[model samples]
Target: MLVNSYGLNGMGIEAIKLFDKMPRELIFEETYVCVLNACSHSGLVDHARSIFFNIINKTEKIYTTMVDCLSRAFLFEEAQILINNFELHHSPSPTMLMSLLSGARNKKDNHLSEKIYIRIEEKFPKHKNRLVSASILLSNAHASVGDIEKSLNIKNKLYQLGLKKKIGLSFTEINGQIFKFRAHDRSHPRSKDIYAENDKISNELIEHGHQFDSAWITRLLDEDETIASVLSGHSERLAIAWNFVANPNTKQIQITKNLRICGDCHQVTKLIAAIRQCEIIVRDANRIHHFYTNGQCSCQDYF
Candidate 1:
């Protein structure tokens, strides 16, 4: 539990220290998974690889974790090779493929995402849930790279099949209370102040030469929405805005999101931490991000 907590809090070194102090005889397959996950979350791929190769009896879960580490580093080729090697001794695992697909989506590597999706379809034809999830990632990969036509096509297909994309949400705590938000949410009593603060942040970011990259947006903007308006409405941004509104003097803010942080939001958070002279910690679906006051992130922009 300590190992996982340390990793999730961007303390990979501490997690590794704890792992090293553990008696080898007490180590189990799950132990390796936790440590490897720690490495993955903290961008310690080299350490993860060293630990992984030393394991004499590697389980499928162990292999998946290592693949996740490499994939998070954008080492797609290495990740795929590892997956291939895993299949040499056992059947293909949907989890490994999904990890690769998710990495591709994050990196906006549409080509690799397509190839992985094809492989997933061929290898796991009977796995309906996996297929739907793969399609979502594939579509997101396309949208991330500005291939909106392909993205729309996939979305249309999913809609026709009665499948829907999961709604993204974010949670944050301020003043001993928890606040939850969705994109463009205005249901809160302090909605006016939240949106006002968000607008203020956006204007400040623009003055800092932070261009709102429309590519990070996965869907078409509504008639009343501009790129800044759409991106600013992201659940994380709303949550962060709420923090400042509820506690104007907050020096530290923590957020938990249901989806991976988009590239634009990642960059924005780093800048916000620096500009606002605060510490921002975000735990996204994939990993944790610690944005320090110097505009540096613990993930080193790997995520």
Candidate 2:
């Protein structure tokens, strides 16, 4: 069955309308997946929950998608309650478990995360590959709360398994050409210029009272210099600086990230948008943030 593009692209209400018009017999797993995905990405918690319970037939993905929607909306208690209620009869899928884990990460509840890790670890034998990725997430969640020991243990386990965490990378298009950047990468010919621009942005933003979020710093550097280096070498920041160098007055810049945008990157993007008078849109794994020149973001800092 053909899935609705609108739904897949975050137009949840429009997708729901079309879903309602589809022939009941034609609606299947993909249809539900499309609508639920749109609702989740767009943070339509009510719509997602309503359709979840009222739909004709549901799949495992539908449940997981609803959890993702509620989590993205910051309804952690509600999401947990829903998962508990569902678990009364059915075992949760890996995706469903990860949705709950995402909620734990967002809330920064290290205790809850430890418990969640237990559940996740119990399923390790069956989902070794997926859990390898989830382990990095668990590690980050722990590290975000300053539980560096557990975080390192998780990463060390992945190392023993010969699995390496994929480095964060971001891409942007300028003058119709794509530019890619990774953290601490200085391979670009204009690497010095990008670092200089990032340094300027960091100092200015710091002067403006933007607090440094050191969680984004994955490098082992002197604590005093780590914040500056992290900010300078961030993939999205590098991409943004490159965009400015290539077209100083570009109205907007778009960057796509392979992982979630960190708190520091989010903070810098807002300030940079205002400072440069350029709208910036960054799409990460979980959501899209539209930073306007006024230093306000479309996600309202929820992400």
RMSD of each: 5.5, 6.6
Off by over 4 Å in 2: 1-62, 69-78, 176-178, 207-209, 216-224, 256-260, 281-303
Model 2 lDDT tens row, 1-37 = 0232333344667887898899888988888877876
The Cα local distance difference test for each model comes to 0.88, 0.77
Q: For model 1, what is the error of residue 30's alpha carbon versus the real structure, in angstroms, after optimal superposition?
A: 4.8
Candidate 1 lDDT over 57-135, as tens digits, reads 9999999889888988999999999999999989999999998998898788899999999999999988877888899
Candidate number with greatest lDDT: 1
- Candidate 2's C-alpha lDDT? 0.77
- TM-score of predicted model 2? 0.69
